[model samples]
Target: MSDATRPDPDPSIAELEAQEQRLTLTRFTHDDAWTLGSLLVELARQRQAPVAIDIRRGGQQLFHAALPGSTPDNDAWIDRKRRVVERYGNSSYLVGARYRAKDTTFEASSRLDLDRYAAHGGSFPITVEGAGVIGTVTVSGLPQLEDHMMVVEALERFRDS
Candidate 1:
């Protein structure tokens, strides 16, 4: 199938919710975005994985990188996934999984433009306690589930540090 037509590989909404719950941070900063983006790029490089990464705060792009072998399309995916984060205050993976739980797509439920708002894995809200969601961290170029898991794991490491 074409990239646009391909199915998203993601976990159940419950599982994704578990991830979101654990990934929350006490604070999210521009420096944190740098660290998270660097860690994700290093991980993908070590695995020889092509991935695109973005960390944005308050409508500003803080960090962005398209790794070797990534295409322009991945950039678009990152934007779309991040849009989901901005709109829902949740991870894009969780958003998509929520749709699946209802046996529908975001477009079907929300009637949003499919190209502008993709409810797929990768993008996560950069939320701070009492501050609410301030930004998003996003990755693309893997199966949706893998993309989501990578971000979650990175956030876990960040939280523990």
Candidate 2:
């Protein structure tokens, strides 16, 4: 039988194609970084939560800040954020995917405690045209959704810049 006449085993073939096509990250510039950091602080203040923000480039710290009374958990958040940023080059999306994957690493109900190292906030991979993942910016200390929102907004702002 022709391939068209054969029944497809994979139900999500169409969806998978769409996802792969959409998994793109755009480049940003140096001025974009300043705007991102500024918006991050603004969003945290608007939410009435203390925040810890870290920006890294070339595997080195570019900028770091902590609002008053930021919790100790920020340390772990930073590490996990860095990992996700490195893994997917987009912190919020990859972290969400990790949570949803069937054989997922972030499964908490299972014997393995992926929750310990699991992160659910916002981190983003900073990239350039000819280079990739030159840096990352991670933020924590608000509600998970808000944290992701903050990063998305910053990236959007950077996108326009």
TM-score of 2: 0.67
Tens digit of per-residue lDDT, candidate 2, span 81-119: 677667655554455555556455454533434544444
Q: How does residue 4 of candidate 1 score in lDDT?
A: 92
* Candidate No. with top TM-score: 1
Per-model C-alpha RMSD: 5.7, 9.1
- Candidate 1 Cα lDDT to native: 0.87
Tens-digit lDDT track for model 1 on 54-120?
A: 9999979999989999999999999999999998999988888788778887878978888899998
- Regions more than 4 Å wrong, model 2: 1-32, 98-117
Q: Score residue 145 of candidate 2 by CA lDDT.
A: 57
- Model 1 weakest 10-residue run by lDDT: 7-16
Q: Rate the local accuracy (lDDT) of all candidates.
A: 0.87, 0.62
